[model samples]
Target: MTPYDAPLPQAPAAPALIDGFGRQVTYLRVSVTDRCDLRCVYCMAEHMTFLPKREVLTLEELDRIASAFVTLGVRKLRITGGEPLVRKGVMGLFENLSRHLRSGALDELTLTTNGTRLAEFAADLARLGVRRVNVSLDTLKPDLFRQLTRGGDLAKVIAGIDAAQGAGLSVKINAVALKDDNAAELPDLIAWAHGRGLEATLIEAMPLGEIEYDRTDQFLSLKAVRSHLESFWTLTETDHRTGGPARYVRVEETGGRLGFITPLTHNFCEACNRVRLTCTGTLHSCLGRDDASDLRAVIRAGADDAALKNAIRRAVDAKPKGHDFQIARAAAPAVSRHMSTTGG
Candidate 1:
């Protein structure tokens, strides 16, 4: 067995992570790296400073921490980043984590990426037991895409999506609905994804961190986007859920599913079962709240599995019932940290 998969000593069964509000924390989103190949206007600043290599947790440490959560009943783990694929040797982490899937300790292992490198790693990711991926694509227009991403190529992302589908991995197109940018393209984008038998999810622009531009001008409510879509397509609500915040609906015209994540217009914190782990080993119990627990220090302190698990449980215990995310003129973000640092 790999070092990460070495069996742990037998101990009493650890209780599942249930927050104070009675929400079970079954999902964990881990950011492997804070670096990205593209700078989406909504996600990061054009000029960004990333964490140093030593400050970030090693792959072995990430595995141990993730394994502890799995032992505590985290069923799904999503490896995220500014771009997870850009991190060197990331596939090795996937391989190590797949052991959980093999042993039935984990139900799913996946990621959310910019799709800039999916063409190069899709097959390997599929082979490592990743069944699906969420590709963040804001716009399809070549010029507009580059302008929004500050140099991202739309063709490369589309090619990567094709390659991922070719490798038998289900693709979910996650587009951030911006009023001044991709709002008009929502119908076309959803149709394009549905046309390909892919799922399309639109997210309202969240006020996460400081960017070069203001978010108030860009914030487009998914509630309005849904009303607009209903004018053309037949949208019927479905009871489908993917263990994340997005609520799904079946589009009758395209015969595909559509999802909406309205963190601003709609508060979805009532059933929050997920926690975020940054690359530096910080545990954020709530994405919209600034409170955090330093898991990196705990790991580096040479804590045993039991101790690590206790730290995680303590973090979960303090998880807020909901986040207070708001966007307004000349107002700072509700959370100062970038979504990348918090595992988008």
Candidate 2:
């Protein structure tokens, strides 16, 4: 067939899916790789073993899976990773998927990165249709940054944020507020992000897996953090709400916005509309719970699109109402896989 004479291909059929809470899951968080440059204390401890390279999904495989999800009513896609930028050919993957984004095949294309390598890839990512970026930067002080990240360069993260903004991508700075460490820097971080036209988000420290200290000590609630910040900035409530976890508010007079994710104090599970796809190809219905359904095995077994969609539907039907960290702690002490592995 001649180039212009070939018939157009038929669009893929949509799949039936349901979330753990029985909600129609329409969002997908895909972890491209389990390898990250920084070893954030909460995500992974020092001296952790990286996933085998062979076990990681290839770019083509990732695109195929994402395409299938998009066909199955996945309107939004977030590229996550141990750090997604660390993966090779990620730009190419975005480029390949961009073609299928017409007709609202994807409503939002976003990414959550540690911001270590974003400086180098921001421009490329912007050109590839990435609309927003959430960078995990907890502290501004170089010493504390190094201490928290365990040998990571804070300058690189700062540069990445700047680069992302320069590339025209909407930026949100994610800060995990600890009790003593960098908790006091909230005002400065807010001022800095506002000055740069970026949103600053303060996230409560979650007890995911094995870490260095007690969960209680590291657990800084949103109320405590907001109490400290309310003294400095005239915090005005915002009606704006995104599908993600953060509760957003605007800073009066500064033209900057702040967000708080209080998973412990104020859980937003009822409005939770997210589902995570792990790097190993398992579909996790909830981040707090360890329950997951294996999609990789089904794909590898030569399952057709109908079979694959059935697997996705079954996975969502198995989604939990919410995580039971409290009960898990009281009971058998359920330890979760690291956040990076879970694509948080």
Top candidate when judged by TM-score against the true structure: 1
Query: What TM-score should be assigned to candidate 2?
Result: 0.92
- Please give, for residues 1-344, the per-residue lDDT of candidate 2 as tens digits: 79899888986666446665657777889999888889888778788787897677778778878878888888889999889988888888888887667566788788999999988999988887887899998888899999888999999988888899899999998989887787678788879888988888998777676766565766677898788777877889998765687888889968988999987788677777778988888888887778888888888889988788788888888888876554223333234677888786
Off by over 4 Å in 2: 1-16, 20-22, 327-334
Looking at model 2, report the run of 10 residues with the lowest lDDT sum. Answer: 326-335
Across 1-344, the per-residue lDDT of candidate 1 in tens digits comes to: 79889898777877889999999999999999999998888999989999999999999999999999999999999999979999999999999999999999999999999998999999999999999999998878999999988898999999999999999999999999999988899899999999999999999999998888889888899999999999988999999999999999999999999999999999999999999999999999999999899999998998988899999999999999999798889988999999988888
Give the TM-scores of the predictions, in the order they appear.
0.96, 0.92
lDDT of each: 0.94, 0.81
Q: After superposition, how far is residue 80 of candidate 1 from its true place, in Å?
A: 0.4
